[model samples]
Target: MSKLLEINNLCVDYVSPNGIARAVNNVSISIAEGETLGIAGESGCGKSTLAFAISRLHKAPALISEGEILYKGQDVLKMNDKALREFRWNEVSVVFQSAMNSLNPVITIGEQLTDVMLAHKKVTPKQAYEKAAELLQTVGIHPDRLSAFPHQLSGGMRQRVVIAVALALEPKLIIMDEPTTALDVVVEREILNELYDLKAKFGFSILFISHDLSLMGEIADRIGVMYAGNMIELGEAKTVFSEPQHPYTQGLISSFPTIHGPKERLYGIPGNPVNLLQIPQGCNFQARCSHCFEPCTEHEPVLKTIAPEHHVSCHLV
Candidate 1:
């Protein structure tokens, strides 16, 4: 498969009167064309920050301190305003976390969806309207609902509308930051089923970011485990789930219940998430890790390929 998005040594920081909080630290990841790569981590682990940085959507005070965000070999970090505007939505779109609630309450769904196309000058008003209806139907929503305001629709319907908006331009890559986090299990499953269908039909790649490891295993071809802003493990979803190398990954897998297997205790990871502002030296997982070695606390470990297409960051590994 061809590479679609490549992030190298990506560092994102939030600067304010308080201090500089390193949200994403030297994180490197890539996604292939038409592939789905899922990033699983707890809250405040830089999952959302990474998504924002990818689209160059991070506002002032929160900035990309260092990194190379390359989309199809283009430097995303270096793009100017006009170029960045053109790059976003047209090539890459984002379905933000709680995107269902992000819909504008004042506008009808049709207007919101059409506005995106109009902003990009991708279509005329008439054409935008026509495409809006089609996009709604594509996501299993009724075309007539396009005229309805966000408040008039169910949460699932609103979520679908948000997805339709992201699919408006048939973007090559869609950064879905917990796209279904707010929905119930049934609704989430339904939405994911629709998402899978849409991806197959549209032939676009997806970067699915969520805290749910089991859900990621259901959707993503590859999984990258993040801890305290660092990607501690990266590998095929099945490999990462069944044979996790990093201690953090192991604890994460153990925390989630498996339906197919026999019942087991939910062994949650101990210790609160490390504060990004005062990130400890060496392995971030060392403090929480059960298999902490002397080297784990003394020096940081670089991500290294341990097996074919499997990478891990830990002194033990």
Candidate 2:
């Protein structure tokens, strides 16, 4: 379980005319080889920003203000154009949130998949197309669909195509940013099951990003909870889900209904998420937290280890 990717003191900011918004603030985490690490948080919590930063895909207005992203001991931030080009897809691939937007509407699925291979690897057109068809089959899509356009396929099938594209180069780490968010529950389940099987077969690590904690519990070996650009809790999936430490983490878990447990009133965290541009001092969850004390309002808590492989950031902890 060697460290495949390590992010240290990462800080991402969005600079605009109005002000700078700290999208990811001093967040640090690591993913082991062949492991699946899930990041759970609501929208605007910087989960997607972190994923984009990992791949150096953050465009204008988005800047990496601080920190290091090390992939197998190499600094991703310092990579030159040529090195970065080789690093993406070859070493890492990203499955974006939307399948429809990710793919080219006009380009045939076969061409899109082959184009990725052709761009990265030294392969003949015939060979690239052959690999493309094989990849489609691997993701449970028929090879015949390769000749079809993106709109010609179902939502689930389009998603499978996106997954196939990510696997085109057999990358060591795949950053899945809400890969199944667009599909129906049944389709989502089927795709996730296939994704799990693919991870086992390929032995590739995954950085799974989603707002769904229950889904994260099912697919992730470990879970990291983020709030207002900060990581509040991180631990084994089972431990974090069953015994969440941070008040925010607890609120997120309690908001979801459980099937096995006796029916109980669902509780939602009060107050809205903090504004990143004008974040207040101390804990970001202080405004929404029912357990907020004086210490929670005055001082920001750093991630403190409470148990083996479990860390929490809160004055109460």
Candidate 3:
């Protein structure tokens, strides 16, 4: 596959009373065309911050302090306002964690979808409606419900509608921030299954951010684990699942339960996520990592390839 998005030592900072908060610190990752890459970590781990930075969605308080976000060889940080407006919806879209709330309660679902298409695609009402209906159908919702209000739909239905609106522009890339966080397990499974089918049909790439490593391993072609604004590991999903090299990755894997397997004590990595405003000197995960040695506490390790396509950022690895 070809590289669709390449991020090089990307850093994001927020201006606060205490000074700068390093939300994303020297992070580098890539997603290929037609690939599904998963970003796994707990809340406040900078996973969503990475996604927002990729799309240039961060506000004034937050700034891209360093590095480049390259989309198809073009620097995303340099796109002009008009180009960014065109780039956002048509080329890259986002299905946010609370995206269901993005649906306007007062407007009919069809109108909301139509507005997006009209703004981005220069389409007429009829054409936009046709496309909207097709999008709704793709997510297994009835086309007629496009005329209904948001409250008229169930939580799952509303979320699916939000997804329909996201696919309205037929974007080449999408950033999904815990898209199934609000759904039940059954509904989450269904949505993920639908997402997989959609990826096959549309041939689009996804940068999926979530705390659920197990669910991500089930669908993502590649997985990257993040901790305290740093990427600790990156590799094929199966490889990371079977033999996670980084101690942080191993601890994360052990935290989840597996069906049809003998139960073991799940040791949630000790200590809270490192505060960006006051990060530790060395490795961010050093406080929680069990295999931390002297070098781990004194020096930060760069990501090194352990196995084929498996990168781990740890002294032991």
Off by over 4 Å in 2: none
lDDT of 1 by residue, 181-204 (tens): 999999999999999999999999
In angstroms, the error of model 1 at 231 is: 0.8
Question: Candidate 3 on 1-317: residue-level lDDT in tens?
Answer: 88999999999988888989887888999999999999998889888778888999988888899999998998999999988888898899999888998888999988998899988887888999899988999998999998899999988999999888889899999899999999999999999899989999999999999999998889899999998888989999999999998888888899998755698888788888877877776787888877878987788888998777999898886
- Residues 1-317 of candidate 2: C-alpha lDDT, one tens digit per residue: 89999999999999999899999999999999999999999889999999999999999799999999999999999999999988896999999888547799999999999999998899999999999999999999989989999989999999999999999999999999999998899999999999988999999999999999988988999999999999999999999988999999999999888757789898888879988877888888888888889998889999999999999999998
Which pairs clash in model 3? none
> How far does residue 148 in candidate 1 sit from its true spot (Å)?
0.6
After TM-score superposition, what is the CA distance of residue 277 in candidate 2 from its true location, in Å? Answer: 1.8
Give candidates' CA RMSD values in order: 1.2, 1.0, 1.2
lDDT of 2: 0.93
Residue 63, model 3: lDDT of 88
TM-score, candidate 2, is: 0.98
Q: What TM-score would each prediction reach against the true structure?
A: 0.97, 0.98, 0.97
The Cα error of candidate 2 at residue 7, in Å, is 0.3
Distance (Å) between predicted and true CA of 77, model 3? 0.5
Task: Please list all clashing residue pairs in model 2, or write none if there are none.
Answer: none
lDDT of model 2 at residue 48?
Answer: 90
